[model samples]
Target: MRSGAPIPDFGEAQLRAVLDAIPARVALIDRGGRCRYANRELAEFVGLTPETALGRTVTEMLGEAAGVLLAGQGGRALDGETVRWAGWLPFHNRAERRYVQRILLPHRGADGTVDGYFIFSRDLTELVESERRLLETGAQLRGSEALSSAIVASALDAVVVMDEAGLVMEWNPAAERTFGYARHSAIGRPVAELIVPPMMRRRHVDGMRRYMETGIGTVIGHRVEVEATRADGSIFPCELAITEARLPGRRLFTAHLRDLTEQRAAAAEIEGQRTRLHHVEKLSAMGSLLAGVAHELNNPLAILLAQATLLRDQATTPELRRRAERIHAAAERSGRIVKSFLAIARQEAPRRTLVRLAAVVDAAVELTAYGARSAGIAVDVTHDPDLPPVQGDGDLLGQVVANLLVNAQQALQDRPEPRRISVWTRRAGEGAVVVVADNGGGVPADLKSRIFEPYFTTKPAGAGTGIGLAICRSIVGAHGGRVELEDVPDGGARFLVWLPCEAAVEPAEAATPDRADESLAVLVVDDEPDVAESLAEILEIQGHRVTVRESGQAALAAARRTRFDIVFADLRMPGMDGIALRRTLMAEQPQVGARTVLVTGDTVLGASTARARRDGALVLEKPFTPSDVRTALEQALMKRDPPAS
Candidate 1:
């Protein structure tokens, strides 16, 4: 194992070249761990030449730190075991670190006893740093994936991922809550079947197919408001946005679904408020016009009746007297029609009571049957004698019934001589059902759906207001009922009103007796001259002495001058509103304020604002009738003086 340590590969010169070309440090060590030889690069790296490095200890060549690290392995190799190890090593000349990967194999003698060892070592700092960076990159990627998964799972909007086939692949917790489907149930399930309504299922499938084929979906990448069915088979509005993903290996689509049910409901409520406000404005104007006409007509009718009575009393012949009576009768009938028009046009708050359904239908028929017969249409009426009463406003219900009858009459106007209208009542699942059928030209098939929608009508613009059926729907809905229209079996339109049956509860007589019939001094205040005068007239008829004032200030001044038994004040007035008037009265004359009744054309005054409910003052909506006024006065009087209680 001297300088002539025979090299194995091709020849001594070639072996030296191979050893020099090699990147690792090569050395020959004996049992003493001395370098019998060293590669040129290793010699040069350690600032030693081959001639200077021959037959030297590795500890003297490399330095103390590297020497200590390799000494044990060198000993192990000389003991006939191969040694391999890796570790950090410090530069011999500079304050820096390097990693070394080393291997030691024993060289054998002719008798197979260990002679010395050949050692190999390479710097692994760059490779190790590369691997470290790779590991750090992997950890960062995993962390990013985890954060993304957490975000997707915790997203408020339902995150649903589907494959090319539209089967749900990822169903997050939000998706589960939104669609009422658990992940286990939803995974691998068709999203269409799970959440699409049956009617839209075909469209959904076709859209997906189209997208798959053309690489475009009409709804893809677009946010759309659509109705989605839930697990419970209930439908609601949702905003859905779908995005395509070109991830590795497979194509997928992700859908973000946000439940817009509450938002839509709120929007619908706003629309409803606007519609109601419009209706109120329209009705208020109509009511005023009708009221004025009715007032003017009533004065003439009263004069005609008075004159007719006088003429009848002084007539010399029976024919003349009968002619006078006929004129009187015609005038009264026209006045009644005017009154009915006024009643229907006014937006009176419903007075729910155990209304006799049979009586209402009978009265509606009586009012409209003659007109139908005159129009050459036969009328038929059927009723279930045992049909129970329903809880609703009698006048409003009557109006609803009348509207049906009138509509039926109008439908029959253009029909042949054999046209007939059928009205019937029956029981339906703990409910009372009233059906008005007309054998005239039935409603057009396309118009059936829109008939109940507000402002939708088939009649000429001048003939139809377009809100009759809408009003019917509103009124029936208010009474816990539904109005359904169906085509009659024999070719006609049948309108059915289904109202929940309620047993008539005989109203208990109020413990407070009627003090309204008794004489009482009352104040009537309204900015409208007609309203004040009409109210005073109605009060005078009820045996109450009334004083009329056109302003809240005047009313208040009048109240202070005289302690009125009951004060009726219009809510909206020029000088002061009824609310202000009441506050002042409460502070100045609390007794009179207690007896005050507020009349308002604004329906919201008593309900919408905190002030209204807080005030809690007795309120009567305007366009009120004589009875509404009398009833309000009676209630005020009764409150002022309870009988024997």
Candidate 2:
């Protein structure tokens, strides 16, 4: 215990017991690298007893590989220096390697000189393995953090992390781009103040507070759509999802945000297209029904119109004439209504003709004036006498005018009384301009751009089809014209229709010039008995020898013997219709065929009718008056013997 003091000298038994109890392999080696003394533990480690291990060299006790490491340390100790070496060594008794720490201290004689050294080796395998595992775990954690940071940086949606107090803790690159803020400016700022819209900021703060206090979140773990504000104060629709992360006593929230502006626009466009498609399907079905109706009703209506006209012309007295005239007038009105329905059906292609703009406006006004008056809205119409005619379909142009008037009337439904609509036509440049103005609320600013779009409407649901303006634009466009809304200064709105003017051409007047007071042999062919009888009577009254046939077969039989000056045939018959009858007659006698006239009640022509017309066979649409009948006869005469041109 004291320096330079050797007190009691224990026997070898006491020394061996002390060395064995130390739990370390202890040995003494002389300067020649051979073991001089060994404790019980050191001797057992090399598979030898204490007496057998004595006087063994380092290489013989451990292994050649183990001795090489210890030889250097022992040589250094012999040179009067204490040496420490720690490494893996395989001892003679163990098959596996052991991590050992060896300390070699020099033991010198009483004189200041180097001597043999003592060796102390302890096992440190478990401690070294634990330290190595700790280092591996640290590397794994760092790698995981790096991967998370890279994903957040490259994510398409905005990634934002906020602390418990709602201050932004992490602002990824996507967040900076989405919120219009740089990372430096966003971090440490209240996230709600940065991206939450002004109207939603209070709600966001309250939600965060509630979650922090009660641990309940309304938006957490769920995706929601909300309005978000940009740095420039613009608000946009944003899809957001939030997640809560709790560490120890602190809470953090991560939000993922995606802008929904384009997505919402696309969805709205698809809906509009769907509505338009549905409307088009309905219109197509309605057109088919109207076409069928026209075919069925025109036959009876034609008989009524022709009979009334003939009876009026052949009336005996004043009273009979008046009654016949009234019947004829009623039939004419019915015919007009049918024509209007045909126009609405849109079953026929537009027929281009020199249309008087003034007449079209007046007719449209008269057609809709009753509805306007019933709604307590006064109507005013004026047309310029000097306005030129436009080459377009008269019925279609009238429809366009009527649609404008009806739309104006509907616009005035919710307005106060004393409402009025005014229509005016004038000559502008080389075109005719018709302006329809109404004293009602004008179109909204936001709806102006989409008003012409199919299925877009401002009228209350079920009250409007939403295709009125779209149809108007289409008709006008087809006619090489344009319709537009002209802003009214005071109130209401003005709709202007501008159509290019065309030189007017008068309808040809058909007259029997060669036989002024003479009648020709005429044959009338019709499937209906009344129709054929009425037409025959009309022809007979004109001093013509008329023959009535109920079917094309009957007409063909009669026409074989008689060289009829003209043949009148109904187009749509039960058997051997007009086209077939005409073809057979032309094969036999080209003159009679050339003078043939085909009549029908159908407004929509078939391909056969079209072919007949192309062959120069005159066709008169049904519901014909006495004048129409005369025109057909004269046209057939002109075709049979064209004037010597």
Candidate 3:
């Protein structure tokens, strides 16, 4: 039928012919469900001619159920409401189904009395089945969409979808957790601005634009590790895998991202462990070599000192006495140098001490200034006197300062006049900041990053080892601090060391002068015969009865026999190591074990250091002198009850 149109005239023959030839299932029924008129299509559906169908009631021609249903609809039209519904009508063959879309309208009499109904019916079997199939397909598609959404919601790795314009379209639950952004805020926002750091946002935007224009992308279809800024503005590392999809006239990108912060931390830890392992290995090799060298040199050194001492005390000639004094002084100085070498060889993991920055900086400056001023470099020091102390290894921090000072001095040496080094410490945030700047040419921007990397140096062969800055970084890192190079406005290089500040100062212990007076029996243990006897004789001169043992097994035998008041054991010896010997003594004779002195040039760290501290035994480094031996005995004596004195 036509839209917004009334029923056409049915009184004319031409109009009646039009209705009969309409190819629709058209019919007109009376108030009694009797057919008044039937089109060619309707007549065929009834298996009767239009003239014969007019006298039959619908309930008689069709079945009783369908006829009653039709009668109710026709009754509504009789009362002035247009009724439209899709219902099945029986075909001529009862076994066949006939579906039709029907409309019923009221036809009023000229006298205003209710008249019969006018029914217009249409056969929609083909259209109805097609819609049924369409509805089923739609349900399936809806289910698939729901499943994809669930998968995205439950994904452990973040999934993000953005449009060709780089605006976020869909952000899954994982994305929300990953970037700390709500889905509502993330969607419809520019992706580059949302998660990309400001420094990289321009590049991200340009790259996206270029890829959209040229169909070539660097990030698309590639998994890359990138720095992503979170909603809180904190940046972290993330691994991103992106794939591009083109739909009709639109393009979209889907990314799978995983946070790499923990992975990066674990990797750094592994690398640090590897470096420490290497350090230990090198320390071990050097320890053995130095121990042997110290042993060989100590025998002659002991002889020289003993002979010089004898001459100085008993000489009648004043000139001979003065000569012996010089010889004695030389031997003592050499002994100090050997002990310093042992300290280097057996470098222990630094024990943390609460110390002020000024003291540490002053100590380093005292050591660095002489050489610095010798090169005509003026040194200036500035400090914020109120700065708090930090919990760290003072010696290690001093080493860091030494490295920076050495680097600054070397830089100044090659520069023109007006060479100067400025060192200062100040409070910055929750940290103590130290800056060492020099009036030498500033470091190149390109080289600044590699300066702290191990084995990376610009100096000529033998002029410098590449490990200075690397060691500085390691030491600072161990203290939970940071060291970085910054640009100086004065056209100089400035290195900043940042150490975390402790909230409250840990009080320093009161110092007591050494009171190592009470001396008892002492044992000297070593694999070298001359080294052991020389150390014993030196102790014997200090008024302690001394015994010499050339091995850990021999030392253990001596301790078992005499419960010595003091035991000096070499770390590396035949049959048993110093650690094993000490353990056996500690288990059998706890009193003698309490006074054991273990000396080493080896890398005695970790478990060894822990055990040494636990046992309260002294571990003096090797390349010791007569004095180091006496000092050990005195400390052990202080720990004891002074031998009933």
Candidate 4:
């Protein structure tokens, strides 16, 4: 009961009292499994006094089942082995069940021989139940942590956790992918040094310090866009969201970030498309305005030319004749101006014809000359007589040429006083090339590749529509040609337009006999009285019976009353326009519709005219000479009634 202790010279009675007061049941057994000694707790648990229990064996004192288990453990101790065991078993003579733990130790004699064993047993039901509950709580906590880890691992945005010292504590899989850093490398590293750009590192560290000290954070609980550096030392845009969590004696920062490189590119693409659409709408509006202006100017020009021609033919004196001829020349120049407007406004499929490239250049120069002069830019022109003609749409080709010239002029607008543009045409292999070069700051090397892209421009904001070169390229491409930026050593931009050429076929001679035969009834319809009267006079002088109507309704009524041999109806007019009038005539009187020659001063109506032509109807553009008028009449008549073979 007592080891090497002589506290107050304790006697055997006092030692037994101490042993009996202890919580554990204590006993001593001999090698035969017979009790040699027992504590008060042990003796009371077996319903026996200590003296009586000392003479009994373990099986006789406890019971068959528990004594059999205890005997084996006691045997090991007796054989010089220490033993321990725990289980739920009956005690107090099998009255109740309780969990108990026991330790058995070998008792040695003075000769070092194991002759007995010592047993120390304790009832541990309360402690065991408490431990079982604690284990369940621990398992639940581990399951919760596993669920959180799974969530972080599967997230699309990067999830990063940093301690109060700004060192990384956790880096999820998304974080590894986003920052190009492995989890092993990122943990325990300073977060700022790992992902923050060099220029922003100091600010990031300062912000963390301020937040930790004052509990006030600028970016915490907010999402923001910032530049982040990758592991390879490259910077890119990133969207970041931070949340502050206060744990026991420490603060943690959780950051969610997403790379924005692709998103930003998509946004930029959308913005560019929006800009191109806006410019297209503006060009369409400009086309509409030009059409209106052409319509207005063609009426007066037609009247002037008609009157001048009659005056010149009837003049008796040379002075009067010269004046009339001069008037006619002025009207012709005005007619060219109107034609330029039509060329720009007309947007339709190409109409192929044998076109002289030099003539296209001349028309473009004429249209851009005044603007070039006002901008203090000099334009020089050159042409090679050997330049072969190309087959293409003249109006579209002229538009392409004009766009290049205007681009050159605008390019040289901010240049020095000697700003100059050189334009020339030459015959290349099976093609003709027109070169437009400007002596100004050239296009940047980086932009040359994308120069022809819609809405891609080198001009400052609001200075250029960015579609000119794109349109030019499209037109040239449609014509089986190509436009390219020719590198010039002189440090200015040069654009070359090369068009495919076909073998030239000489036009057969046309004999015009000064005679008018087979006179027919003709109707001229126009919104402008002058235009209608002038057209009527032209038809009358050509020996045709002419009728004039200032409105389409009047023209339609007159056509219904009398079967006119031919009808010339203006495309745009009040009430019913030429297109509607023609439709009615075609339904009511197919002959008159077939003999119709639709007239339009608005070349913007080119698309409509093109449709009319496809339906086997003839069309005449306004501001025409007597020759053009006669040609239109002949074509209409020829279409209405073919000559016998």
Question: Which is better, 2 or 4, measured by lDDT?
Answer: 4
Instruction: Give the per-residue lDDT digits (tens) of candidate 4, residues 1-645.
Output: 233212112134644665566667888787767787788898888899988886687889877877878878887888899897768887537667878777787866434687787787867676445434433543456535565565567666788888889898778898998899999999999999999999999999999899888978888876577999999999999877687655546666778787878756644543354345546666677778877888678878888988878778778999999999999988887888788887777766678999999998998998888999899888999999988789999988999989999999988888887999999999888888999999889988888899998667888988987778998999899999999998889878999999998796958855443333568799999888888888888788878999898898899889878878889998778799888888888777776777788887666654677776677767788788888899888767665443333
Best by TM-score: 4
Error of 2 at 53 (Å): 88
lDDT of 2 by residue, 570-601 (tens): 98888899989988988888888888899886
Better of 1 and 2 by lDDT: 2
Give the Å error, residue 428, model 4. 1.9
List all candidate RMSDs to the true structure. Answer: 32.0, 33.9, 31.5, 32.9
Flag the better candidate by lDDT, 3 or 4: 4
Query: What does candidate 3's lDDT look like per residue over 1-645, in tens digits?
Result: 222222333223544555665545666666666676676777777687866776677776667766878878888888888787766676444786877767676654434444666666766565444334433443456535465566566666787878888898778998999899999988899988888999998899889889878988887865577999999999999978676655556766777787878656644543444344445456567666775576556546655665556567667998988987898777776655554343334456787878789977876776677689899999899999889999987777887887799899998888899899999999999999989999898888899889998667888865765778999998899999989999888698999999999997576853432544545677778886765776677776677788888888878888878858788887667689777887787778766776778876543322564566566668765455566666777666556432321
Worst 10-residue lDDT window for candidate 3 reads 1-10
Write candidate 1's Cα lDDT for 43-152 as tens digits: 88788897688767777887888888778787788789988776788867647888776778787653467878877776757644543443354346743545445556
lDDT, model 4:
0.79
Q: lDDT for every model?
A: 0.74, 0.79, 0.72, 0.79
Q: 2 or 3: which has the higher TM-score?
A: 2
Better of 1 and 3 by TM-score: 3
Name the regions of candidate 3 deviating beyond 4 angstroms: 1-350, 354-390, 409-413, 416-437, 445-471, 484-491, 500-516, 560-563, 604-616, 625-627, 638-645
